[model samples]
Target: MDSFDGFVTGLREQLDGPLPGTSAQLTMAPSYRMTPEQARVEGKSCREAGVLALLFPDGSRVHVVLTVRRDELPDHPGQIAFPGGQREAGESLRATALREAHEEVGLQRDRVQVLGALTPLYIPPSNFCVHPFVGVTAAPPALCPTDAEVAHILRVPLDHLLRPEARRREPWTLHGSTVDVPFFAVDDHTVWGATAMMLAELLAVVRPLYPSLTIPS
Candidate 1:
């Protein structure tokens, strides 16, 4: 079987098992649900979209690619995030994801096979309802970040994410409201906010099958 199939099989098996009791997992699968109107009123009106690259080298080890947004951007500047943007006119979400991926990180469609999508997320600060789609590339990518939008390209080892210690939470005061934001510390770099939320959900879905998958401590 192809590596992608094997990975998905393993992922499914892991998710079917017991759910981890990590903070990341708990926050992603919240205790309460938000209504559509409530979600919209809570700065979720911004309709921005994006993609997540579930890149597997030689279709084996599943790694995730994130970009550091340029400091000049008004929102989410200098943050480690998935390479994605708003959907342009007459474009499909998949197409938009692929196009934005290429523009931001020089990822060619030929290298990636569109797998499917995860649930959409609403980011409050940016007012964007970000849609994260998962795609797998056969080979390791030659990433080139856009100078103006992307400051750096991060190819985070999947194993690192699977390690519980690499991910954590910290206190943050946003618009005078205090809360704990999820953060992933891979080496010296930190990943938080919506990007971390997506990662948490990704882990939720993929963790059931991979028994050895690590949960953040």
Candidate 2:
């Protein structure tokens, strides 16, 4: 937890108070290892492309807003995930993340100070390529979730994420196969997969600014 304490202080000092720019943008490409033949055969079965936003609030606190998908959704049903969805016609990946954030949660584009984007990440089970965007919000947001698609909204603190103890690798067994999932145990919830990957990148950026920062095991 000492490492996490250092991380929190560093994040607050670096990003807290007034920021220099109104917004920034980054293009991220996150890769995954999947069976190529299976990918070709699946041809994007349940495959999708989406985006997620990282919002920094007051103090050294950074909040990652995730959603509980409506049980009715055919894929990724009821899972806790970053706010995003499949790309729409004529939409760039950035547009998709922003648009989805607005539709899924009541986050307006105007309120978000988009810092940049991260690499794209692929999910094999769903065959998705997700684009992640990072933003620093000036104020805490009041979320209004669309009841049909979102059941609950989760806010995870960045400080907690940097704690090494909060980090672990969990093994998942599915379809007679096993995979190691990087995870962060926060409160009563677990953050993993693309979400965890994005967090890792975020920590990499913020941790260096403050050397005391450490990502949980």
Candidate 3:
């Protein structure tokens, strides 16, 4: 487990350094990706939100926990996303991330060792400014999704995303505009938009440490 410890150590260190930020996020971003100026010009009031990218280890490989929203959810229905939602009044973004993870996926906050946060992103479609936090659970979590919001729970091996074939693009029409969308294909789910953007930074931070990990293909 030297590699597992290394992954955790590397994550904590990278979070303290200058992040890849929007440049890396934009690599996987769609053409419709909103800019801060546009958000201001639209005069849209956005709710503050937070999400957790929680990692775990199974044997020598590291995995991240994600959730697919139920098709009936009012916002971003049927989309694969990190477990999160708008923060309550007086709640810290970090607390929001931990709390949402617990409520949606039954991940006990006490079990999570939060590393640090990634760059905050604004989602035009949802009108939310999402703060993404990186965290880890020493043992595999007993994750159970709330039937009201979650449709599936995905435990994706992090190394799977490091491969050349992990990223792909497709044409899609959004709000009457056609754009080429880059997304990561996990299982049968298409992870794109703000969720993919957040993952982009997470991957950028984790990518450098892959050479030291002893994961099997």
Candidate 4:
């Protein structure tokens, strides 16, 4: 098999075993002040959500899809995020992620192969406990973005993310205070917050498989 296929195999193998978990998530977290245990205490009654890190082969490399939320949206407006939403009744987290991806990006459920799940993260701002899953498609998806929810679809090559340079910090105002925010600079988009944290975990899992890729500690 090719390198992309091999990477998929490695990812599936990694998922089947133990995950890097909260330690990985902390690498890209906004603030290290609050630990996962602390967050759990605060998120006792948080709503549940699921997101997909959908990967597919594009030419010779693998790519992951992320969406830019429409500016008019009520939550996280104009922010880059995974295609997902709150869990629905009588559905598994995997199902919820796939359904939301289909609704937001027209990525059919059948086209995706669910690899496995990462650690669930609590978003204190939105009061959401988000469960992220890694999925793969053999071919690139023909995307159809929902104008109401998605402003643009970003298909970022995995190689780009593996590069240490892609991860950077910038000053941003939050809660009336200016703070440095860490983000992945991908395709003219600043992928920060929960999305960045999730990506960090995924990379922590797969980066070791490719010895050539250098990620900062």
| Cα-based TM-score, every candidate | 0.78, 0.72, 0.91, 0.93
In candidate 1, stretches whose alpha carbon ends up further than 4 angstroms from where it belongs are 1-5, 8-45, 58-60, 214-217
lDDT of 3 by residue, 1-217 (tens): 2678888998899998998887778778886664545323134468899999999999888999989988887877899899888899999999999999999999989999999999888776667888899999997899999648898999999888766577889999987889989999997889998888889889888887887544222
Candidate 2 residues 1-217, lDDT tens each?
Answer: 2333454455555544443211111111112333333223234445456667556564666567878777789876766777888898888878788888888887877877665655455566666766677665666788878647898888877666667777766677745677666566877666665566555666655654544565432
Candidate structures ordered by TM-score, highest first:
4, 3, 1, 2
C-alpha lDDT of all candidate models, in order: 0.67, 0.62, 0.85, 0.85
lDDT per residue (tens digit) for residues 1-217 in model 1: 2366787656545445553323343453222222334223244447768676555654346678889888889876788888888889888888888888998888887777766665566655566777777777656788898648799988877766777777676777766776666578976677876677677767666654356665643
Q: Which residue pairs in model 4 clash with each other? A: none
Task: Tell me each candidate's RMSD, in Å, in order.
Answer: 4.8, 7.7, 3.4, 1.9
CA shift of 107, model 2, Å: 0.5
List where candidate 3 sits over 4 angstroms from the true fold.
Answer: 34-45, 212-217
Backbone atom clashes (below 3 Å) for every candidate? 8, 17, 0, 0
Better of 1 and 3 by TM-score: 3
Local lDDT at 14 for model 3: 91
